[model samples]
Target chain A: MSSPVTTKPFETTGPGKQVLEITDLKVSFPGLFKTVQAVRSIDLNIGVGEIHGLVGESGSGKSITAMSCLGLLPDSAVVEGSVKVTGHEINGTPEKQLARLRGGGAAMIFQNPMKALNPFFSVGQQMFDVIRCHRDLSKNEIRAEAEKALQAVQLPDPHLALKKYPHQMSGGQLQRVVIAMALACRPRLLIADEPTTALDVTVQAQIITLLRALARDHDLAILFITHDLGVVASLCDRVSVMYAGEVVESGSVGDLFANPSHPYTRKLMSTVPKLGLGEQSLDFIPGQVPDMSSPPAGCAFNPRCDMATDACLQPANKVLVVSKDTDVSGKHWAACHHVTGKKPSSETALSETLEEHNA
Target chain B: MSHLDQPADLLVVNKLHKTFTTKNGVMTAIDNLSFDVKAGETVALVGESGCGKSTVATCLLGLQSSDSGEIVVEGRNLLADSKAQGKSLGRDLGIVFQNPYASLNPKMKIKAIIAEPLKTAFRLRGVELQQRIIELLAHVGLGEEHMDRYPHEFSGGQRQRIAIARALAMESKLLILDEPTAALDVSVQAQVLQLLKQLQSENGLSYLFISHDLATVEFLAQRVLVMYLGRIVEAGTVAQVFKSPRHPYTRTLLDSVPSIDPARRDELKTLGGEIPSPLNRPVGCHFAPRCPRASDRCHKDVPQEITEQGHRFSCHHPINAAEE
Candidate 1:
């Protein structure tokens, strides 16, 4: 994230505002023989305080997009493209400036707390370090601030929990502690990479609720990266469905669920298990994510899409942005060859949703 | 023999107990856990991350032994065996771990990884060995084309297929899937699970499927075992267990997985406090501490398994809300 500098452009403000804007965001890695492109010419706009879900299977370039925003990629990584957060250009900034941007612009909570946290340090000390690094405060002030953050996440007996090491806390508690650390900085934009995947379903709900409430209370933007459709359905305001290093679909939660445009997105929604839904039934897309070292031309989702046309075999059928309600509604956007007039993955999906709403 | 009176069990876990001695004290990980898995049944050990599910699986596969118990797999006692007899036990007990790439050797060829277990179980070393590897690969939804490729050549789901193939290479009666689908994508999870179901049905192999997710449990398991603090609080057919969950912990866990359709509101029961540390497992009913209906008796007396209508529960107060 270290190139030369540019001048400050504008001040970011207002409700439903764009907190993050990424233009041609590309990240690549130097493989043994050649370079591997992890992300390619991606553009995304995350609305203010709304959870923008980034959904995809592993190696779909979801994590890299988040990491690149904070300049946390490895030595082999070559990041190109612009990542602007809070009206501050990030892609080519100095490491020191990038570090400053990190807890200031957006905070991140990782997938595995056990690995993300230092095992040697206590929960309190880790929180203290993060808090003190971001803010200029006294020792007592830092301790009090950290405890308050912990309490907000509903960690019981914050003082005692603070004294305990990361290893001492349960997986669920450690995750809450991690959440507290992220919230401690009060970042304008939050990037969470599968934080709740390691926790149980009940614990997962608690964490999601904490995140949702925190978003509402603090008026911060969240980019929740996960593969679980059930989670995205309930938590995210808008979702971007990625496949093979490219986002095939992006739309409002209800619009996307009601009418999933991308074949991959449609396939993903069908896989979520529902109550009294069906047995001896499964909606599946054939094939897997292509080897990123050399991805296929045209649509990345074309290989597995059952409704894929020959046009999908071409190079330029990316995402088709659509308005749900009105002109300039900007409510929904989908990346797919076909926008309408085709049966989606499961026949009963829409009706079932309606039935649920009616009941 | 009637179903209730039948003495024959494909996998009989009797008084399985495992304790890890730390500097602080002895932690009772799996406390006198006992269950039975009939032939061709998928018994899901459903719980959060550290509720001794893996411990029980390791014991059954002979990778780890219980402190005091007997694991009878296909009529052979896994824990009772002497050193010489145990070698035969590992052959019949196959395991599929969480990460396929972690279990498999990236350096070795796919054929070699699948054949390594076969060499121990069947001693096949000639052209027969190569043929067996192809057959195993095909069983796991992978083609013969995947034979020459390395572990890194495959996707997460494909790697899992390779691991499943290797597990099946032993031709074992029991296949332990410890979060096999947890590491894969949800869409890919359905495919792998469907393939697993097909293999299990055609081969008549039993699965001791362990996972933290209850949704996956409902999908794959015929019989569900709800574990908490190293104890089985509830165990029954998936319908009997899920439709009428007797244990509060089981119900709470089910409510936790956010429903895909937002309109459906099965009020989630989030257990208020953190799951009590496994290191200091409650002496009586392990769930009593977090249980909403915890009584004085629940804190003092161990809950006995209530065997009624082909169901079993270890809760002191197993309420029948449906009847109400």
Candidate 2:
């Protein structure tokens, strides 16, 4: 690890600009025995006011990708390639510079609101602390700013909320306060990792609506990370499906849903039990996520993918799944040798074998 | 009341009530809750947190005795001599908790965890006990290789499978699955749900599936009960309830779930206000405070249980068929 002091300070270019840009970003954590490849080579970009969903199962490196953008990875992590936030490189940025960049250049909210907040302190004190870290303001001015931020997230009676402690409020309200704290820094980009997973459905809906509104109104780019396909479908403008540290599919939400080319993505989409679908047998990808320390040589999802062939033994390049003639921006792409641009057939030998094994 | 009146009903709860005395005052966790699960039937109890779902599970498991209720399991009243009938009750009911990581003993191997229930409940030992553990593991999609590994070695999905295996160790007629799939990923959840469905069919297992995930309930359960503030707001077949939810709370819950269909993205209507504190519930209908179509009568008088065919809902102003 090297630390270099630079005279230059980090600054954002302003709203209506590209918020985040990643090029061939790879992150690996070095351990005693072996190095865990948490994130393989992947490219992602989020523009101003764009809500990009990073959908993946556990250990697929979705959170790692987001953490890398903010330089939040541990010191053991050897992050290669470029991670630019608001046109400023963050991959090799110093801790001081990264601290300055975070909460203002980019902010993040986690799944559990209680875990994110301090139970002992009042919500007002925490908000003030977050605001003070990012900006130099007086006590009265900071309190006003905190209240304003809370109001922006649509917390009814922001004044009352400020006096209340984390335990005094409900889960939904605590989440709102956390979001407001994140927004108090006036960040251009927001990284929400499974923000609504801990919440109830009704509360999840409210939070989703709040986030969508925040992205649109505040012109904030959001990288929403979750395993729930339904949330991605409803909230995101574009989505990237990850499997075992690699993004298998990336495209507009509509395009990806209509024609999920990647076998893993298709299998994942089919697994979500849809409402009003009646009592039907759910289709599931047979195997669990591959271990990161010693993943498969070529495609990580090949073991579970029904479409896996001998060609999949080698690393697959991102192939354009959409037609060449279409003028759609962010053209549909899948990192699979067998991207047929067709929906997955219902019957497969993989599921059959799984059923037989269970039987 | 005699369970012989309904021999087919595996587990029945008649007017169950459970109250807790908190620091502030007494809290009614469950208020006159009544429902039943037939032999090999999957009856889901869906509700958000603090809705007395867990209390119902505890009461059924005899972990907590209800204030006044008859918990009948296979023509046996569980409330009667629950202390003396502990061993038999354990054989009759097995429970799978939400978090697999916390449920299992981390220090123990998979075999010991599964054997704990079997050895204590059935008093089996030696070759018979080992064989039974293997069979249970096999039933849950795990091979003999995983029998020696500790809980830490297995993944979330695999740990959940082990939990299910232990839950089935007693061959308990009714398995109380309390948010079993909530802690798992979507793909893994699918696998577990499939395993559960397959297990139910193969062994004719009755499941009192308690979950907040409506989609999974719709998939696994034949009958569904929507709970709110410790009361059964609505009950019907999956098709009937999901297709035509009459209660306002049920409608709100169904509407709140985000659809995977991208076209219906804008249809999510968030329910206003949080669940009322159980200690200080509303005067009449518990959901009246947040009900969109709450009438003056709803707040003044408790709604009677209105039954139509097999579907029942306690709502003063139920949504009409046209509204659906």
Candidate 3:
């Protein structure tokens, strides 16, 4: 483990510019009997103030991808390819530099807040420590900074919350505290990995709103990872759906949700419960995610795909660039041999589904 | 397939109260909660996490004694005289916990784990036990030969099958499933829920299904009980509760459900903050702070129940602009 080092300062670039860029990024764990390819050569880039959602089912390798970006993966894990935050290369950097970059350049809020925050430490102490670690500020200034961050995430009575332990806070509150800690540093990029999974529906909503506000206010690039497409639709600008370590599709939230090009994406949309609004189930994708150990020779989702042809059964040629629509926006790209026509719009995706039900 | 208009209930909970005396103060986990599940009916108990839905499940099983009121399970006082008889009220009830992972013992093989509850109620020889275990495994959609596989050898859905098999082994008349499918993925969750529904019909078993997922509940529950702060805030048939939610809490929960309808703009009521600390609970309605339609009257007066055709809402006001 390395001590403190140089902080990779936040963006000097103008707004709407790229904050983090990943190209052919592959990560693997060297533990166990065989090397496990956790994150395949995946490409992802989030522009400043853009909410990029990594959506997929469990073991879809979304978390591993996000974790790898911050250099949060274990020492046994071998990472390859370029990971850049504000155009500063991160992955192969020394431990001390990487540690310094974590808070100042990038910050992460994990799924479970109870486990994320230390049980013994007061919320205030945790926030102050984070502030002091990343910023050269006085004790009183750090305390004020901590309080403001807590208040930013809408933790009522920030002073009291600071004095309280992690256990004393509710799941929602604890998550907000995590957000507060993350924001205290005001990193250029914030990676939230299922930050609301442990919270109640209502509490989850509050946390999502806080995150969105924080991103908008600070013009911070956010990598929001979640299984719930609803959250993705609500919070994200661009969305990337991962399966078996590789990105199956990436598109604007509206485009992806409306007309998901990949067959697996379509199947996924069918299973999620839409309350009384639309579809009935949690969009249940057909077939389980393929085992990464001996993944499919062809497309990973070909096993689960309803429209998979012989071409898909062969190894993917390259990341297939799916044209946007009849009037190709070129925004929606799906890695599949299928998808010959228009990507379904939100209205079409649903009405077409309703038509299938009626048929 | 038809409406189970059975007036006589298999399980009736009448004003059942469970208040725990934590050193800080009396935490009323379940307050004046009353509802019933008829034979073969699935009654979903839906609420936020700390709304005492789990406590109601506990009281039903006689695991936790209620502080006040009676729990009548087929005219049997679940609380009374069982201690004097030195008998455990283990047979009539079955419970499926939220996590199939934690509920199952990792060390035990699937056969023995499923057979653990049966040994108490019925005596079986080696062949008979093996046969029964095989039967249960098959019944739960597992291979009959899966009896030797340990719980770890199976997926989450399969492990839940093992749990269900154990519950069935006891021959429980009423099943208290506490968020059984919550841990499962939607596709797997759908299959498990469908299995539960099929098992209920075939065995004529009653289920007290508890879940935060309203769609799942709406699909399964014959009747629905809306709990808030350990109280039955609203109770109705599934059609009644879902089609016309009378309580604000139920309405908010429904609204919060991530919709598949893409046209529906996402101004979902971000129910701000956590539920006020359950310890120093306010004097009036528990949902007063969160309720969108909460009035000054709501903050001052405790609302009484107004019933219409078996659908009840305990609120001074539950109307929204959209409904009106």
Candidate 4:
């Protein structure tokens, strides 16, 4: 069989090296009984004008990581480590400074447009509030900019949209309006969390196309968070997978899909249903994501992993970067011990690990 | 078509039309839709969100009255049948909706939920009723231990299994599965689908599967019906329609799905504009407004359904292999 063609290189370091960087970040909520560790120590980097994907199942700390970046997590969340946007720190920055950075440097669009946009106000009024908060433009200029933003999203009859309420528009139209508001701020980084999950298939295609174009033409750095790996294959350049509050794998989309070393990644890839194919059953990973309050020690995926060993139950290093000679990109990294050259890909490693446990 | 041409034993729908008078105006939900589900075969109704697939399900279950149509179940005309006969005919049809959480009652135990249909259909009671519920639980892969627990105690997959058991209580010949796995996770969805496939083979059941997800439909359905704006655009076997889609709308719908392969990450071929309001549908062909190959002729007159080698499609200009 022919080898699958490797698409675009995941890491596209543009003119500027990096736009957003996080080092050793961790987030936890201090509960009355026990602390809920939402995100473990993790590091990430997004280059200028690049679309980075954060892929994971629900409650996998993907959303919490993005929320930590935007400084939008609840006050009960206690965060550690450094979050830098353009080499400026946001971890311990004052609320006033963070607001300025968020209003100008970073913006976010949520999944539910109806909940994100206020119902009492008109669409135009919401857009105007955001633009006015970031800029000192007058009434007519603000209205003009709002109309331009709406038109940029290709909404039909921009002026009529501004006059209408959120309920009056369709789901696709409401999402376009949300994107229009985010772009109106002229932010360099956009964090969209499951933006198209609630839309129809045709409308989802339209939204994805729009986001891809915006990232290319506007030189915007995007952190596209979603649970669908198929979408990541088509849209994202680099992908990072999180499991149980830790990033278990990170690499370029091409290198990752062609050779997924981590068992969790492999199981996830196998579950994607294909089109134009005959009836067949799908391979599934057993069990569910562990409760984060008291996660297992070594690897969170051990319970569901078919290749788990005794070593997998104990504490280990956070991540181990693995590179194959065939992948000249040399950017592929996996956190699994077996794939990192500590042991071979055969069944021998598990027996060895098991022997060590017995000894 | 003559009586000899139609499949007599299976469920056959002919010239089904349904229109609703909404506050916006009157809207046609199903426009001259016709199809059939063969015995022991699965027929899928594929369409977008508001294309009237749910309306067809409601009309088939006799929950909602249709504007006009003929519904035939096991050679019996459902519309022309008497009220007393309709009550007995309920056992022939069983439906499972998308959300299992809302469908199952929180207060009712699993045994009572499964027995609800058995008791009403046959007035079965005492030891017979208990034995039937146990048999249904076993058929759906549940056990006797699960009979005492409530619906909230089970996981999503297990709850769906209970729902399936309830549907199969009356030994239903035809099951209407309306987006049954949409609310489930991928791994859970796989198990549920596997169970359904096994049940179909064991009981020789016929299924009318309705969903917007093409992937699941490909796995479950033997015959595929592509719907758009209340009309069947294409009808054929899964291999014929998916491998060589003749209708432009069918091609558009299939092209919209993002596959697992990373190689095919090029520009997506999207249809122009949104689905038009049902109240303000175009005059000639419903899809003429969005079709890429629409000529002046397409806008002026409706095209007839063309049948070629058991594959039927309605289109003025079908995309050839070279163009595709």
Q: Across residues A256-335, which tens digit of lDDT does each residue of candidate 4 receive?
A: 77777787888887776677668676886666667788887888888888888998887544333444534433355566
Query: Between candidates 1 and 3, which one is better according to TM-score?
Result: 1
Indicate the worst ten consecutive residues by lDDT in candidate 4 chain A. Answer: A350-359
Error of 2 at A317 (Å): 1.4
B1-324: candidate 4 lDDT, tens digit per residue: 123354345898999999999999999999988898888888999888778899899888888888787888877778777572366357788888876888899999999999998998879999999998999898766788889999998866678878888888878889999888765656656666777787888877889999887888898888999988899989999988888899988888888876666677674556668888778888777789888889988888888899888889988887765766
C-alpha positional error of residue A51 in candidate 2 after TM-score superposition, expressed in Å:
0.5
Task: Compare the candidates by TM-score and give the number of the best one.
Answer: 2
Ranking by lDDT: 2, 4, 1, 3
Q: Best candidate, DockQ-wise?
A: 2
Which run of 10 residues does model 2 chain A get worst, by summed lDDT?
A1-10
- Candidate 3: tens digits of C-alpha lDDT, residues A209-229: 676777777888899998777
- Which CAPRI category fits model 3? acceptable
Off by over 4 Å in 1: A1-16, A30-33, A315-329, A341-359, B1-8, B83-85, B105-107, B141-158, B264-269
Error of 4 at B1 (Å): 27
Task: Mark the regions of model 2 whose C-alpha exceeds 4 Å error after superposition.
Answer: A1-16, A323-330, A341-359, B1-7, B123-135, B141-149, B152-155
lDDT top scorer: 2
As for candidate 1, its clashing pairs are: A319-A335
Query: Against the true chain A, what TM-score does chain A of candidate 3 give?
Result: 0.86
Better of 1 and 4 by DockQ: 1
Stretches of model 3 off by over 4 angstroms after superposition: A1-17, A30-33, A277-287, A317-328, A342-359, B1-8, B83-89, B109-111, B118-165, B168-171, B320-324
A82-101 per-residue lDDT for model 2 (tens digits): 98888899988889999999
What level of docking quality does candidate 4 show?
Answer: acceptable
